[model samples]
Target: MRQTSYFHTVIIGAGAAGMMCAARTGQGGKSVALLDHAVKIGEKIRISGGGRCNFTNRNLNGHDGSPYYVSQQPRFVRYALSRYTAQDFMHLLDKYGIAYHEKHKGQMFCDDSAQAVVEMLQNECRLGSVTWYTGCTVESLTALPIAPAGYEQARFGINTDQGLFYCRNLVIATGGLAVPAVGASPFGYEVAKQFGHHIIPPEAALVPLRFEKWAEQGFDTLSGIALPVRISTGSGKQAVVFDEDLLFRHKGLSGPAVLQISSYWQPGRHIMVNLVPDTDLAEVLCRDKVGKKIQLKTALKQLCPVLPERLIDFWLGREPFQAVAGQKWADIPNALLQQLGQSLNHWTVLPTGSDGHKKAEVTRGGVDVKEINPKTMQSKQCEGLYFIGEVMDVTGWLGGYNFQWAWASAVCAAEALRADEHI
Candidate 1:
């Protein structure tokens, strides 16, 4: 590229992690520069949580960790999260006087707007005096030979219209390819590849799913239906059961349950849904014999009125698979009835596909976390290179887990880098 330039640290992506890192590093008396290709900063933050921005969750249970991440190295996120918890995030929110309320299942959201959260982060960066450039892009990166201090004097001499600015440290907090309109690009993954880091193959997540039209006419009719469900995928190796509203859309399914479970789901695999979750299917049926003997369609319709009658008719069949579809619950062969029970208890239906990146809430599979230090978000292999937020492989469940990861990783890296006087 052009003649290499220089700086103490350069952070890419003006999202939460980058902002946090910049603010912290700057506070430590280090000169930090932040950049973003987008015209606006924190686009994801602005639109998250239905615009209210569910900033963090109280559901960060120490007893359970993996629920928040699926990584090539599963342990990668544990260290970062341990160092910085959701409560720390709330402190920052409080510092800004950003009023938030605890909603369902411990999710905390701003009562006003997501913009408030973004502005608070921006204000933090400003207070730290971290410089920033918007509507900018990186042309390329290459490493230099290791310097005398054991840590190499590596340089990322990025080419931008503003000028060629090189940095001893480079942090990628560009986030994932969830919403391209917000300037979420594959640039982060490409940078990781440039540094010889492996990628976990990214895909759109936390989005609605669309079923094939021909076989799903009945399902399509339930455009406004919603219900609680426990969905499973990957045959069983990966599954999530969430009791939340699953709203029907013209395309497919959406809402909390589907969004939470979608992270674990893969293509071409059956997604098992528990219509009446937890309770034994036989017990539920036996609870009312007369109800059991009712038409299979009628029973399913009764079980979940939110579901369309036509869908029940299609699944229960006019003969319950082997017999007539509308056979009485008692007339339904015991063996076949068992199959229906199995279908309800462990209903398996593979989705045609999910909504792509354009509508995805978050991205699954990003920069492999193994290449980075969990404690500080720094690259173990490449000095001065840190990967944080959704740019790394650490993802979270539907709630505010991902944002929590961002704040945690950023704080960790910023603190660590600030501690380093070498810069």
Candidate 2:
């Protein structure tokens, strides 16, 4: 913990991945140092899932990697993915006697409070030989030369207000610039760039969609309305789709489906919604022939339970639905039926923008995976330089997949460092 010219491993973040990596490396008999600039560790996790902390996903177990992850070479995540999977993470929690519950969709969250998870992790690190440094803002990294033995031997030349501390190995676990309040900084990406790691464009993910100007009035009324729907994008390029609940916010749309699909979405594209999935609309119309005399508004309300009754009256009423609704029972206009069915089935809205990094649940892109060794979480381009956590482009779904990546990557790097001797 003293100001040293050098140490074995230098992990530069105190979030989930950094903590996991530090613990693993330290447990391997290597002197590992963890540094963070935040006042509190795991601030993001503390406030996650409405303060319960959606920790990890139970469905994933030792897979080669996941399609959900986006990286320059996504295939590289295999080693970490297998070494420390969702099952392994859950085991750790169980060992700690932490009470958690699976909140639909394999998301494990604390039953009591997010604070419990943070305490458990901090306890784990304490049990190890990890040197903890908090409230230390990393100014820059000056990597020292590596010895012939492959283990880091040079001073990291770390700069902070606390003092100058050095480490043989450097880890960029500084995370991404998502929620700056939790110390989300571009420092990670900047450090990677300094060390010559290719970085992908970064953006906000798992945030609410902003509404377009024209529909603001309609969307305003639907703020609290939420329904089970399949949200998707275009085809050819993989479309984002979720068979989950959708909330119509005053700003725009949100909820599980939007959050899930937001990762795959690109700006300026319409976010498509399947109001009634796996169902035929023509059949619905034919079945409703008996109620043909009913007003157009009443018919539409009957078809889509998600649509507000008031909206139904306004949109599908005599004048509004005239373009889609048939005239009478005998003459159920073919074109009108098809149009109404298609519109209801394939509803879409353009997102003016996202909630941005301020409210984003996670960052989308990061250090390009091609430059790092997926097996070891070490820099393939810059020896002794490693990246973990949101700093890597490998993002997960809205669930706890991201946290799992952090744990897995940390273990991978820790084991690799332990096996190698310091230069």
Candidate 3:
């Protein structure tokens, strides 16, 4: 092997966390190298939010913890998020004169393009004089001996296609397996395993839900239809609900509501979708059925004015509605009307599977949170070893919560590395 060149910190992955950590660590007067296997850097950010990049959210609830973010140890992220809030990143954006606007639910997106956000992060690294190693794959990683008795921790020797490099601190910000086309890999999880860290089995989050039954039921014909809904998955404490737009796709369901619940949804479990959450269909139908001469289908339109006409027709053609077909609103039995209302309000279905990593906006599970320091993001078992961003078990809601976690965790780890003199 060639002689190993040394640095203060070597971060594997040139994505959000790695780049941000490199900038912070290097700016703090430590030598930093940010490396990635992809030829292009920040492809994830480049394609996020339809190219606008929802960089961060204003609703992080940073004073406590981000309520939208999830982890096995839910409170583990509190410290990092509190230390570096979404407002902190907004200030950074202001410094660069990057114009952004808030969309629904506090999702902030760039007015221009996601490329600008990537460039801004790149410029931040430039200011810190951080080195870049794109298009290079790390062949192997080895834990070196502690530097005599004076050093605080042992260093890491990383073998790469380009050459051998060593660092006092090794940060795995390699992200998760989502968007594999952009060169995502299991390298980070493998590194965690090499050092005795447990990896939580990863699943696709923030992706479309597919169902074979729905496709055969002609629900696929409702593609392009979207309406606000209240969606819930799981039961008891594990249950999660989101009030957002639900979209009908050719295969199954996609949209904010489905994406939000997808993280908590397990295989063989059913999801509850309320087509008309804001209105009590039972109450409306019961009150109006007493004297109305209109048909049941017409009354349904009045009850759910936002629902598409085709979807209303489809629902009217099924089950109880089919039995009461051609009947006037007043002629239909009150019991059947109640049943129809209940069905509309509590529609439940099983998802065969998700769109998987290729279509997943984020990976739900990763390096187990229990194995990392909540404050410093350092491995509990390995000194000078850190995991950040999606590589860790932390997953945020569909909005900008994930990006906020990336920023907060990167800053936390960077600060920890800077405090270590040997690192």
Q: Estimate each model's TM-score.
A: 0.87, 0.91, 0.96
lDDT of 2 by residue, 1-423 (tens): 535445688888999889888877777778877899887898877888889888888767776557657655667777778788888887888998888898897888888788877887787777677888899877656875543233346556787766766767888888887889878989888888888887899999888888767353555765677778888986765665679888877778889889877877888888788776766665676656664776555566666667666545444544435554445643466556666667767887878789999988888889988878878888887777888888899888878888888888888888888888763
Instruction: Give a tens-digit lDDT track for model 3, residues 9-95.
Output: 999998999889999999999989898999999999999999999999888757776467777878888999989998999999999
Candidate 2: worst 10 consecutive residues by lDDT? 146-155
**Top-lDDT candidate index:** 3
Q: Go through the candidates in order and give each one's C-alpha lDDT.
A: 0.77, 0.77, 0.89
Q: How well is each residue in 6-50 modelled by candidate 1, as lDDT tens digits?
A: 557889899978998898888888888899888888888999998
By the lDDT metric, which is better: model 2 or model 3?
3
Candidate scoring better on TM-score of 1 and 3? 3
True-structure RMSD, every candidate:
3.7, 3.1, 2.0
